[model samples]
Target: MSRQFAILGLGYFGSTVARELKRHQNQILGVDRDESRVDALSDMLDHAVIADLTDEKALAELSLETYDAVVIDVDGNLEASVICTLHVKELGAKEIWAKAHSDAHYKLLKRLGADRVIYPEYDAGIRVAESLNYHAMVDFIRLGERQFIVEVETTERLVDNCKSVAKLAIDRDSLFLVAIKRGEEVIQNPSNDTTLQAGDNLVLMGDLDALREIGKQI
Candidate 1:
């Protein structure tokens, strides 16, 4: 189902989300105090409005409650961001997501009823470090404190090159081979007898440390 989302700022982060959501055929309302920002996204969103998000009177006129989710993306201006978050919460927005510039901003956003707090810079740093540390790690999604779903590329240097999954000897208790991607083919929950080819993409879910160990050994 398509969702209705309102983005309060049309900066890099907010504009990116608005464009992606629009690409997916979702209804998006883009709002920004800058006329240029609003104009840039005017034809892309369901509605594009130029107004100060912190103004309660301006916010009230927009019928914010009708949106499925409201995103506050006024970065750097911590005070204005907080006020906008609070205003949207008071307007009865179903869900509020905000971008926090720092730890203190994150906590304040949470206290002000933000459903999700995004630290884009911090999160991007972590991803870059992970990719740098493990050359085989294509990407990963953190599931918990120490668990993750990782995508690894297979190489001839691995101990079990061209071997069957059943004989790979990876600790099944700590690691689970979820799927295998070979060129355009995707094999989900591949059979134990399935053979891994060189250059195959392996989708794995397991403890982070264990995944790293596998990355090293294989």
Candidate 2:
């Protein structure tokens, strides 16, 4: 079954979300306060409309009851974004996702019934910082104080030339080698004896400090 989603606002964040959602198996309805944006996306989206989301009556006209998820990304206007969040929550949308510009905004959105609040620009900045510091890492997830899971690009050196994962564990002291993200193929709980290859991505889990040690070696 296909899930349904609505994206409010039509600036970069909103439009980007709409486009990306279309890549998945879902029904997406787009909302924008700009007439040109609404018109442009009309043919591209399942439904697109031009309406001031801050207008409570106008927002009430939206069929949020039908959507499984609602994403609010009304950037450039803080008041409208907050109002939109409130309206969507009141409309009884299943999941309300809001994009926030700051910590204060995040808290406000969460308090206003947003299920999840995303700081997209800040998150992307963090990712860029991680990338700049660690060439081996494609992505990083901090699971606990010490534990972390990293999506690292596999090289022929790591795959063919690197020693067995068992010895690597002993020598390098990496706790868990969870999975290998080989492009689109995800190998869960990969074998200790399995060879790493170029074009493969390894999802490794272990103490962050220990992984940093292994990461430095690689």
Provide the TM-score for each candidate, comma-separated.
0.93, 0.88
lDDT by residue for model 2 over 46-78, one digit each (tens)? 888788888877777878878889899897677
The reply for model 2, stretches above 4 Å from the true place, is 155-161, 170-174
- Per-candidate Cα lDDT values, in order, are 0.90, 0.80
Give the deviation of candidate 1 from the true structure as CA RMSD.
1.7
lDDT of 1 by residue, 1-218 (tens): 89899999999999999999999999999999999999988989899999998899999988989999998899589999999999999999999999999989999999999999999888988988988898888889999999999998887866255487776657889999999999999999998889878878889999987887788756
Cα distance off (Å), candidate 1, residue 3: 1.7
Model 2 — which ten-residue stretch has the worst lDDT? 163-172
RMSD of each: 1.7, 2.3
Q: Would you give me the overall lDDT of model 2?
A: 0.80
Residue 37, candidate 2: Cα error in Å is: 0.9
Candidate 1, pairs of clashing residues: none
